[model samples]
Target chain A: MKTARVIYEDGKHKWIALVRDPNRPDYLIDSNEYLVIDDDDSLLLDPGGNEVFPAVFSALSTEFDPRKITKLFASHQDPDIISSLALWLEFNPQVKCYISWLWASFVPHFGGNKETFISIPDGGMDIMIGSQRLQAIPAHYLHSSGNFHLYDPKAKILFSGDVGAALLPPGEDDLFFEDFDRHIRHAEGFHRRWMGSDKAKRDWCQRVSQLDIEMMCPQHGAIYRGDQVRRFIDWFSHLEVGIVKG
Target chain B: MATVTQDTGRELRRIVRTNEEIKRVVATAFKINLMAMNAIFLAKRAGQTALGFGVLSNELRRFAMDLQKQMSQLREMTYGSVNTVTALVKQARLNRVLERARKESSGSGRSLIDEFMRTRHNLVFARHREQIAALNRRLSQMIADTAQLVELGSVLARSAKIEAAYGGAFSTSLMQVSSDFERTIGEIQRSLESLTKHQDATL
Candidate 1:
């Protein structure tokens, strides 16, 4: 079964992370799906692939109406990021997908039409959920060439997408990291290879460092809180990515 | 039970594929509507010499409008099927997960899975299946309606061709317009035939 944890909650606005399913097969990579609820309106971030749709849908249905998910934020066009799009749209035909303009055409192959997507430009834009304004911060080349991370100023949460994603081994399913060093170990190899550019990493680090964030949520692994958020930014800045060894 | 799952899976794939095909048909229908307008314009340019052609062209234009309206309705109906079939597929995947969970659990955990399977899972699955069945029936009806509309378009195209032969000095231009009508209507007919085949396979 998947676990849904409320990472941040303030009155009607809440951030719920549907994390870690033990029943998932060993081969399928585990992913985290975030639901940002503002009153009756909600947005689901990187809703995962088709394979994990049942788990994610059932988990979210327990707390929120999957039909009420008015918007979807795809960090990039990876299968694990937005492949469940068709299924989500199936459940709620009115849901509009917010993806980078670069992927507006390509991502629809997973399922959707012209009216279904709200394309965010390369410079990024503000997306409103109820009265709350969430910024789509451009984090291109951290992994996918056309990628953006979502930041909520009021909640001080930066949904980092694949930027801080870690491939944790079996039975290591804590929602938030207790040890920064141990957590960094799980994330190190992923950052070195999956993240394709040194310059992009530096730019992303500099831009996000200015933000007042309490929790940095990633798609694949545990969330970084408080001091670990800064520590992750620093670690990611120095990391030599796009490694092609002979 | 496995056969039912496989059949549902096939039906889901057919729904998605047919939806895409319907989009193409709708585009073609829009084009036919435009072509009909162009034919009326050309018939006016041909003057009194093409009076018979003008009247037939007007009828063809009306036929095109009716076809476009029907195609739009058919497209709208497919959305419901697409939504329901997609939900059915999701439920199937959940069933697999629940079965896996059941094998790994004991006592209360197993009982919980059993209860969910007996109640929520089964109930939701049956509901979705029924929705899909109803949508399929409606889809079949719409396809038949569209096929009949396409047949009417064919007759209008044939009559327009005969009328074009009486255009005297405007005969060549009128013939070209009539040919375009025939070709476009043929395309719509083929699309309908493909939809019928897919609908039959799905059923």
Candidate 2:
């Protein structure tokens, strides 16, 4: 539902990161990303299989060559998060796979018989695209152990895979919409309905609040703006505490 | 989170809802039957005290059997459909057999056909109309009670966050409404007996 595209660099090549579906939205394609830099190293963040591959390529735009992508980073084990990793890795022969060691157990499930990708160390990892650096913020308990949110710190944007996601209408490619309250409701509804455990909700909320969120490009639903941020947090607090009103 | 809580809350409401419905049918039959029975018991007593047992008592006692049959059927029906209607219809047949027996039992008493018809007219025509009206009133109350139950179910089903004090109040209110149903059945039975006695005397 929510996708983000931004240009970041001290100089040289411009970078575009596309955040695809996080939560199971209109499409089951799952969330992924494409980090497009100029003539050098193009990267993919969590390539989802089947339906999402086309979506990731389409969002990458014609300027970025699918085959020229030099790095593929899979944040977690979920088939939705990394099922298409091997497929994309096959296409780009020169690409290095940046697979998480904590989540490496998921490779077998994704039909990746070989452990070829380099590991992104726990706590944090940094990737350089020209002069700009992309930080992998640790996101644990976000469904599974091997998960991290990609933060474009300079752009003040958090690609919160499932943490801030909300399922929306299918084939909807809106990165951010004006009516963000509707998106907030969608996220709130999904949090309690699909994701179980009060402890989990509290943990996710705690982890996400630390980031200086500007454009909240979630995996699903419309992008929420500044005002909707506090509203969603307050709403989650009430649900977690079980304080029902008339 | 709310949905899980709402589902359990809805189930509790359903129990009260079903209990409320069963309450009405039981109450209605209870009223009609208790009235018809009283009519026979009192009617025969009147005939025995005023006239003699030979002519009126024996005739009226035969009428008591009809009332007894209907009462028996009404009792059976309280648990389920049972034989409430079939037994009532069978009473008509029993009346014929009993009528012949009464004639044999009393040599020159009045024709039981006339007695039976008159007794029926007193119950079905003169008394039952008013009893049925009262029954309808109780039925109306049952409707309102169930509507309240459904409203309670829907409200409780929506969210799991209402205060325990509010839930306790709602439960208490529903229980009170439930007790009223039983109390109403007793009241209806009392009212029907008053009328059934009048018709029961003539036969």
Candidate 3:
């Protein structure tokens, strides 16, 4: 029982996030799937693993005709990010998958073909959803060596992928972060262990700091909205990442 | 400058055809099971004169039902494999589009490609392609199971025909019918075996 909620909306151009499934197995890691709908076109970001496909697919179908999901964005080649690809292709084989050019050849192992991909350059580029432009910003080495985040300039929302993803404790399933300090505690260990490169983290923080982002949506845990978004960037900038003490 | 590859379209069509064939095989197996049940009912009406035929019919029906279950499993695996292929082909095409754009965009697209090619040749493609190959092993198992069912059906048919010949003078028609039943079952088995072979090779 997964639920899709409209997290950001401006008429036909909207951002919908599909969150927690009560029926999902406890052994598997939880994930949040985002759908950016612009008029008739829709792009699904980090749709998630094969095990969660049935729930994600059913939930997506309920919101809109799943067939309208014209594009897919994989921040990196992780199975949890793109493994449900084969199942999604079963619904519409022609849906193109957007990924970093680095994992262009690699991600297919999870499921996808050449035509099904739209490779984002290492620097990232603007992807068109109907007439609207969605920027694929470079967030490389946040966790994956070849990662990019989706940014909607019109909505001023940055889909940070795993950069701000937090693996929250049980019984905390809020959609947006109300307590920034408390949420950062859950994310600190993840960033330290998974961020991998201090230089990459600094580079990403500096670049994104320049943007007029109102909301920071991650692939897991609560989203950061308004002033919390600015606070998150400032906190992340000064923090030393990728050095594991334990 | 990204030209669509002909290989993907052809491969997708092949998957569609393969799924259709799997459905037909399962449907045919169910029909054979029904015929086997009818034969058992006729043998029952004939009483002790055709007791052997009744037992053989029951065995044939059981085998047919089992084959039907196996065929259903095969169908499921085929759908899974085909879906995997569909995704692979689609992704490949999208990769080509980006590669083409990178080549044509002068230095603009080169940044993405250059950085991406930095730590290259991970062979994730080969790993994913193995999933499709695994489906062939699944098909092979189905073929082996069907071969065993066919052999058992043949043995039962021969035994039933011999038993029919021991009938009374009024049982001549029953003997002839038993032989015809054996031939029909043999023909059906041969046809199914041919189908399996064709599928095994194509898949």
Candidate 4:
């Protein structure tokens, strides 16, 4: 079974994290899925892969109608990020997916036809959920060539995709980290190897540092909140990435 | 309750798999329409010598058209089943998750979970199961109807084979065409039978 926690809630608008599945197999890496509900419309971010669909969908159904989820935001095209595309579309054919224009043709192989996807350009764009606006900020090559992070201005939450993801050890099910140094130790190796470019890292850090983010959510492991958000950005800026150990 | 959830999941998976098999069968059935056209052409070439064969071929063509129409309907119904079963599978999964959550929680949390489960049982899970049963019933009925139509085609095919014997000089060609019709119709019947078995297992 998986658990969903409300990370942020302001009236009808809320950010729910579908986090932690104790039943998940050891070989499979655990990932986080976020649901942004703004009034009647909702968007699911990094909806995870096919293997986790049952757990994610079941966890989500406890709080919201999985079918009524109007939009899907794929931060990048990693299987862990959005491989469950077909299963999600199966339940709601009307729901549209937001991925980079680079993957518009590629992602359909998972499921869906032409009318199913709304292509987000290289520069990114504003995605609307009811009356609220969520910006798709470009964070290309941080891990994937065509990557983007979602930012809800009103919620002050940045869904950083894999940018701040940590490969925490087993049973580390905390939703948010209290100590930056302790958490960064888990994230360090992931960023060093997964994040391929120092320039792209600097670019992401510089741009993200400008935002007034209260919560920086990653696809994997715990989230960065308050001052830890800044601490992560600073740590990532100086870190060397894309190491060739061999 | 866990067993029910597991059974529902297994049944939904079978429905999806059966639906895919039916689609492939339907695609194979489309070739019957083309074979019917070839039979018509062969009947025309035989002229007055094969007048009886000509009439039987025309009837076979009509049967092909009717079968195609029924197949289109069956295809549409199976697609509806796919969509419904997909949703049902999700609900069953939700039931499992809620069950696990209930086991883990206590006190106020457990009561809250109980309330949520009651709502799901009444408003969602039960209704979905009923909906799926209704859809499966309709699918079974459709498959049966299509099978009856294929049996009629089989009769026409056998009749055409007898008529081909009287075609004089064109006997060999007409005989070949009638044999092709029998084989094609037989293939369709086997596929429909497979579909019926699948639907039965699911139900």
lDDT of candidates 1 onward, in order: 0.86, 0.49, 0.76, 0.85
Q: For candidate 1, lDDT tens digit of each residue in A139-231?
A: 998899999999999999999999888988766768877988988999998899899989999999999999999999999888999999999
Ranking 3 against 4 by TM-score, winner: 4
Top lDDT model: 1
Residues B53-98, candidate 2: write the lDDT tens digits. Answer: 1232233233334434443443333323122222333333334433
TM-score of every model? 0.61, 0.45, 0.57, 0.62
Tens digit of per-residue lDDT, candidate 4, span A53-128:
7678777877886658878999988889888887676456687999999998988877778998899999999999
TM-score for chain A, prediction 2: 0.75
Compared with the real two-chain complex, what DockQ does model 3 have? 0.02
- 1 against 2, candidate with superior lDDT: 1
Worst 10 residues of 3 chain B by lDDT: B116-125
Model 4 alpha-carbon drift over 4 Å, by segment: A1-187, A203-235, B20-28, B200-203
List the candidates ranked by DockQ, beginning with the highest.
4, 1, 3, 2
How well does candidate 2 match the true structure, expressed as C-alpha RMSD? Answer: 29.0
Query: Can you write out model 2's per-residue Cα lDDT over A5-78, one digit (the tens) per residue?
Result: 66354344554655653433443544536463634665566666544554454455334545467776666676
By DockQ, who's the top model here? 4
Model 4 misses residue A34 by how many Å? Answer: 12
Best by TM-score: 4
Q: Taking the tens digit of each residue's C-alpha lDDT, what string does model 3 give over B1-203?
A: 12323544655666676677667667767766876777687777778778777787788788778878877887888788788777667555545533542343333235534443232213433544577667767766776776677677778767767876755552575566556656755665665666576566655
